[model samples]
Every structure is written in C-alpha cells, then in structure tokens.
Target: MKYLETYRLTNLPAKAYYIPDFISDAEEHFLLQKITNAPLSKWTVLSNRRLQAWPTQLLKGSVLPTTDALPTWLDDPLVQRMVSLDIWRQSPHDRANHCLINEYEPGQGIMPHEDGDVYHPVVATVSLQDGIVLDIYRKTEDGKREIVYRIYQEPKSLLITTEDMYTDYLHGIQDIDVDKSLYRDTVANWDFLSDDTKQRIELSGGDLKRKRARVSLTFRDVKKVRNLAAFLQMK
Candidate 1:
C-alpha cells in the first residue's frame, strides 16, 4: 500500500495518519474477545478508563523487566502490518515493545495530556467498538490551552501520530455523551472518513451521538529496559 497516499491527515500537523477500516470486523471481534477474556487482574482501573499494559508497565518509567514478547493474539497480523509500514523503523528498537490497552465506556474520556517522555515519540492507536472525537490542543505562552483541532477516530481504524503531532500537541477525548459541531469544518480528518460515517454525522445535523464502549490499543517502544535481576537489585 502507498501509505502516504492512502492514509494521510495532511492539514493537522507534521504527521498523523488516519486509516479507516484498517482492520477487518472479524479481526476487531477477535481482539475484543481476547481483551475481554484476559484475566481480570490484568486490568489496571483508572478513574476514567481501565487499561492493561502488555510486557508489563515500566518500572519507574525507565525499566522493563520482561523479555517476553507481546502475546500472539496482539502481535500477529496487526504488529506485522505496522512493521511493514515502517513507521517505527527509526525508533530505538525498530519496533514497538509495549502495548497499552485502554477501554473507555461512553462518556468516559482521558484528560488532555501528552504521552510524556517514557517512550519513543510515536504512537499507533487502533480504535475498536465505537468512534470518538479526539481533541488536540495547543498550549499558549500564558499557560492556558485552546482546542485547535479535532479528529474523529472510527472503529477498526488506525490513527498514527508522529513527529510534531506526537511531540508538540496535547491530545485527549472530551467526556461528553454527544459530540457536537461535527462537520467538514470542525473535523480535521473529515475528508478521509467513510461515506457512511460522514452521512450519519450529517444526518444528525452535525452532532454525533456517542454510544457503545470504545477500546484503544496504543503501541509504543518504551525507551528503558532492565533484566529481572537488575530490577530486583534496584529494589
């Protein structure tokens, strides 16, 4: 696939790719099953969303103790496709070593924040189940922030953020049951969405109602790692 031509979000920042239908419905179903079937303890409950970190969460944001790879269910075709795209080729490890699975029920969204410095400055997010609008903000010199753009992420779509988009902007989803003002002018990737999605938004008179749960699989390469012995010794 000519990725540049097929999935480009040109108006936003230096780099952000929105690939609709990146995964098949069957694949999405399988992934949801795997996520839901995982042992309950694997999920770390946050105030707004619950998450499961693969290969374990970083130790102090700078160390990974396990050499074990991501589970086959998570890695197989998806990771392989991501690797083929070569988005992470320049990253330290040349591939993502971690996956953060976050589940957000309707009306639950994360606060506006950057991904921070724990990982390579690139993120590949796969949305499942439902779609939501991710608001991007710019911090002003006076310390206030303003919503500069919004991207609607659809189910089974791949949203890749890199370079300026990943490093310079704060991205988050609003905790609203309905997303208003959705139209060609308000949505950054409006031109790239599927016709059906666009029609639904238009039919609602530019307001998109939110329903169903949404899950995001965020893949990144953590910059730190340590063997188990070294990790234990530090403790």
Candidate 2:
C-alpha cells in the first residue's frame, strides 16, 4: 500500500487519509447482512444511535478486559485490509483487537470528542450504507472550540486517523438530515471522493440528504488487556 500516501488529506491536519470505494458493493452488502443478523442482545441502544462491541465491551470504560479475538466476519477482510496499510505497525498489539459497530439513524449524531488514551492513537473507520460529513474541531486560547475542517465520508470508504490528527483535534457529526455547505473548498477529502458522490452533492446545491441509516465500523487496539488464561483453564 505504498500508494496510500496518495489518499492523505493534505488540506487538513498532519495525518489522516480517506480512501473512497475501499470495499466492493458485494462486501458492503455482506457486512451489513452479518450485522443485521446478529442477536438482538448484541445491540446496545443509545440515545442517538445503537452499537455492538465485538469480543465484548471495555471493562469500566478503560480496559479491554477480555482476550477474545474479533469474530471472523469482523476481522477477515476489514481488519485484514487495514493491516496492509501498516497503520498498526507501532501499536501495542501490532493490530486492532476491538471493533465497534455503530449505527446512526437520520438526524442522529455524536458530540465532538476524542477517543482518549485507552486505545492506541490510530483509528480506522469504515463507512457503510450512506455518506456523512465529519466536523473537526480545534480549541482556541480563549478556551472555546471551533470547527477547523470537514470530511465527507462516502459509503464503502475507509478513513484512517493517527498522529497529530488523532490527538490534536476533536471529531463529530452534526445532528441534521441534510449535510450542507459541502464542496471542495470546505471538505478535507473532497478530492478523494467518488465522481458520483461529488455530482450528487453538487446537483443538490451543496447538500446531501440522509435517507438511510449509516453504519460505521471502527477498529482500534486497546492498550490494556486482562489475562483470561486462568478463567479459560476452568472452563
């Protein structure tokens, strides 16, 4: 993946990349099917969205606490493809050990926040079903926050964030049905978007309405893992 540099969001911060059409249509459909068929108990419904944590959720919101590996469906192609980029080469586990499948319905969104230090600084996100705009924020000396950049993530795309881009800024999506003011000048990854996506946004007068729920698969390597060897021995 030496050519990965070509996908870097140069107009934005120090390190972030966007790859449009990272997965084929068949692959997206397959993943969505798997997620759809998962047990109802696996889903943790939240105020604005629903999510499933693979291999188990973090213990006390800080430790991975379980040694169980991600399921084959979550690992094989998605994580494997990320491995090719070497983004986890320096991570504690040298690979992603946790995956969060988050589903956001129309008019739903998350507030701006950082991933924190529980996991490695790198984060790999795969978008499915629909597209959305992520707003990046930086704090001013006056102790207030302001949006500094924006990213339009297309369906079947992969977005990687690390280094300064991971720690130096906050990222979030706005709670709106239609993402407005989208164009080359306002979006960090505009040049990397597919032609069809660009044309659609343009035809809508710089607005892209959200008609379907969007799912994001976020992968990261937790820095802390509890030993389950003794527990396994008794099983």
Candidate 3:
C-alpha cells in the first residue's frame, strides 16, 4: 500500500502519516485489557493523565535497565506491523525499545512538549478507545509558541511523526471536554480519516465531542541502554 496516498497531511510539517483502522477491534481490545490489567505500580499519576513506561524509563537520558523483553501483548501484531513499515529502520536500534502507554480520561490532556533527546526523532503512536485532536505548535524566537496545526487521531489508528515534524515542533492535547471547530478546513488530516469517522464528525456539525476514555501507546527507539550489572553499579 502506498502509505502516502492513504493519509497525507501536506499542510503540516515534513512528515506525519495517519493510518485509520490500522489494527482490528479485537487487537485493540486485547491491548487495552493488557494496559488496564497492569499492576497498579505500573502507572505513574500525573495531573491530567496517567502513563506506564514500559521496560522502565530512561536513566540519565542514556540507559534502560530492565532487560526483560516487552510482553507479547505489547509486542506482537502492533510492533510487528511497525517493523514491517520500516519506520525505525534508520534509527540506531532499528526497532523501538520502549513504549509509553498514556491513558487520558475525558478533559485530561498532556502539556505541549517535545520528546527531546532521549529517543530517536521518530514516534509511532497508536490510539485506542476514543478519538482526539493533537495540537501541534511551532516555537517562536522569544520562547513563546503558536498553534500551527491539528491532527485528529481516531481509535485503532496509527500516527507516525518524524524528520523536521518531530524535532522542530511540539505536540500535545488540549484539556477540553469537547473538541470543537472540527472540519476539513481545520483538521490537517481531514481527508485521510475513515469514512465512518468523517461521517460522524460531519453529523455532529463539525464539532467532535469526547465521551470515552482514550489510551495512546507511543513507541520509540531509545538510543541508550546499559546492561543490568552496569546500571546497578551506577546507582
């Protein structure tokens, strides 16, 4: 399949690929169950959302400690598909070593921030449950920011961000109950969404309301890792 022909967002930055229904409903449900069933300690509570850093978070921006491979629930199908896309082929690892599972309840969203230097400049995020709009911003000379674009992420869809789009801009979700002012004119990937999604948005009079909880699994290749022994010695 020609990925570019499937979901093209020309108005935005250098690269952003949106693939609707990238996973089957059963796959989505299985992944969601795995996430929700994780030990309570797996979740780190934030002001607006909760997240689980798989294989453990980075240490000093250079190393990953946990040697256990990602659970099959997190690896199969999804990760396989990602590999097939060759999205991480150019990264140092050639495959994502970490996954950040973020669960956002209604009215909860993350602050606008860049992923920074911890991981390679590519992020492949898979959305589950409800859909939401990702707000992209451009940095200004004075350290202020400006809203540059919006990308709608639907359930079971995959969004890949790379190149200048990843390093040169900041991305986040707004803390709002409803995503308003949605239309082809405002949504950067409006033409790429599934027909059902587009129809629903149109039926809602161009404003998409958020009703269910949403979970996003962001996959990235962490460039740093130390063996368990070395990591333990450094601590």
TM-score for each predicted model, relative to the true structure: 0.96, 0.95, 0.94
RMSD of each: 1.2, 2.6, 1.6
Which candidate's lDDT is highest? 2
Model 3 ranges with Cα > 4 A deviation: 1-6, 232-235
- Of candidate 3, the 10-residue stretch with the lowest lDDT total is 1-10
Pick by TM-score: which candidate is best? 1
Q: Which sequence of candidate numbers ranks them by TM-score, best first?
A: 1, 2, 3
Who is ahead in lDDT, 1 or 2? Answer: 2
C-alpha positional error of residue 185 in candidate 3 after TM-score superposition, expressed in Å = 1.2
Worst 10 residues of 2 by lDDT: 226-235
**Model 1 agreement with the true structure over 1-235: per-residue lDDT tens digits:** 5664468788988899998888999999999999999999999999888999996777776677767678888888788889899888898888888999999898889999999888899899999999999999999999988999999999999999999998899998888889899989899999989999999999999888888989999999887767778778879
lDDT tens digits by residue: candidate 2, 91-153 = 988899999999989899889999999989999999999998889999889988899999988
lDDT of 3 by residue, 38-136 (tens): 999999999999999887767776677657556677788888888888888899888888899999998999999999888899999999999999999
TM-score of 1: 0.96
Q: Model 3, 142: alpha-carbon shift in Å? A: 2.9
